[model samples]
Target: MARGMGRWRVLANVAFAAGVLALAGFGVFQVANRRWQVQPTFHVRAQFPNVVGVEPGHRVRFQGIDAGVVAKVVPPGRPGDPVELVLRIDESLRRLVREDATARIVVEGMIGARVVDLKPGEPDAPAVADGALIRSEPAADLADLMRRAGESLREFDATATEARAGLEHLAALAADVRDGKGSLGKLIRDDDVYDNLVALTRRGEKAVEKLDDDLMAVKQTWPISRYFESRAYYERDKVLYRPGSHRESRTLTAEELFEPGRAILTPVGRTRLDEVGRWSKASGRSRSEIVIAAFTEPGPEPELDEALTQEQADAVRKYLIDRHGVDSAGWFRKRKIAAVGFGAEPPRFEDETAQAPSRRVDIILFTPQA
Candidate 1:
């Protein structure tokens, strides 16, 4: 009996030693992993619209490096306000985080814990002060993505069903046409109807040709010829024709319209543009186009000159619309206003042979003769 009691005592001693060693190992592991927060850290506040899986103790990473952990997740005070997170980041990151640094919540891996990913800003940007609020980019939710994918699949199924129905209906209509059951099918089968249609079409073509010849003869007559020439009415082909220009234009110097080498308009520039707006209104051609064209002298930097001309033209267009209520779109959505920039290379017009000004803006009221 005494021997058995001694054996039980030995077993208890072994069990106790094993428990002590396990506890010591656990403590060492925790210390090695820095899980007990032995290092100094600072707080940074960030706001996010949705914090679905984020919570306190979530890891924070700076450019993929583990920096710290989330200390708190504060709920929004108002309904529309974002959820704010307080991050306990290591003090070493204070120099890296900038005023423009952005934060985003991302998953570590498949089925892993959610973490805060911090992206540093430009080197020239000001550093973020400790305890400052940083902006967060919106995080995409897995549940939301899955829901959208499901909705798309349903839409695709619905569209396929509709397409199938339309094709079946079309096939039935084709069968009916082939069986000579409808008016179209009857017309296709009747020889007398086809013959009559051909004869009528030939007569119509002859009548049109004769009318065209008479019109041409009248246009060549003495008085009519003079009238046509004055009007610049000429036919080039059966489908194309040319008409004379009823175009009037006003030219303004760059010195009069803008500050030197800049697109900014001056007081004098505004006055000149105002006059242009008034002139367009008084032109009495509501259907005419209001074209604003800007030109610049050839410079060492052609790109800059082109950009300047474009900006100048756009500035004038904006002023006319804002100050004069110019109708940009006319009846039937026809564009009545246009702005173009010709940088040191002006396109040739029929009656325009004189050299273009070194730098100029032209406001033209153009109407083609009807």
Candidate 2:
């Protein structure tokens, strides 16, 4: 009888040991799966325009902390409705999730798993009820980003290739000029050509001056003077070359306008702008359009340079409008005032070259022809 009792006891011990091992394994599984919660959880709903790989069992976070899991992903019943996501959040976070809270599907780490990131609302806002909808922001489309990046890379590669070819051509031309082989080489090397060019330039200037004088005399004489006065005609020394209208421009160099490498106006810059303001006030008409354009030297980053030029242009525009009382708008007509920046890409003008003149601002006035 004692031997029988011993056998029964051994069987019972084995069963007890097996049960203990099973319980321990269950606990480990629950902890590892993030389901070992002591408190209850509540449901919340969010709608997204694009889920982008989100599915059930995906983690949800509240301000970057692991707070829940997505319970369901319900597709729209009809068309145009957003995809709905049901989140099971810890009840402890109920007060923190207010009515104004926002949700968005974001990649957790650098190209890591995707999760629902929650941004809690204001503290004074009402707490969100269970099963309440939370506003969702559209997911950041990784595919679109990748596609744009690829296009930019291709464009950069093409630009680099063109630049290399241009450099090679320029190097060959320079060598030819040095060897005095081409027409340009001869023009640069010959003393007689240089002297003739200088003399021709002087003669051209004199002719222009004489023409101006003769035109002024004619305007001041007889019925022409009366006609010009009615039309508000003024003598323009330098005019912008455009077909449709009369446009005049005052060019200001960056060296005299802004602090070195910065957008801030210097004392000299202010003085120069003050002179321009006075000119506009004295001669400008309300019906005319004023354009303030700024340019910068080409650099490695075109975007930064463009931004700087824009700021400079805006500064000039602001000063002219605010301080000088330049007419930016008319009573019955739309304002034609505009500010633009062309970084490293100056528009074609007379005697344009790759020189310091490229880095400058032009205040242009466009007036209707009488």
Best model number under lDDT: 2
lDDT score, candidate 1: 0.72
Q: After aligning candidate 2 to the native by TM-score, how far in Å is the CA of 28 from where it should be?
A: 8.1
Per-candidate TM-scores read 0.41, 0.47
Number of backbone collisions per candidate, in order?
0, 0
Write model 1 residue lDDT over 1-370, tens digit each, in one string: 9999999999999999999999999898786445327677787899999988998888899998888888899999999999999988888888888988889998777564799999988989998888889888988786565446434433443454455565556556555655677887665766665555556555655655565565567556654444333222323121111145477778899999999999999999999888888887777365666667788889998657867886798788779878986654456544355666666766444234246477998876667777
Report the C-alpha lDDT of model 2 over 154-272, residue by residue, as the tens digit.
Answer: 34544544555655565566556656788997768766655565565556556555655655675666434543332223232123333565677788999999998788899999999
Ten-residue region with minimum lDDT total, candidate 1:
233-242
Clashing pairs in 1: none
What is the lDDT, from 0 to 100, of the residue 162 in candidate 1?
58
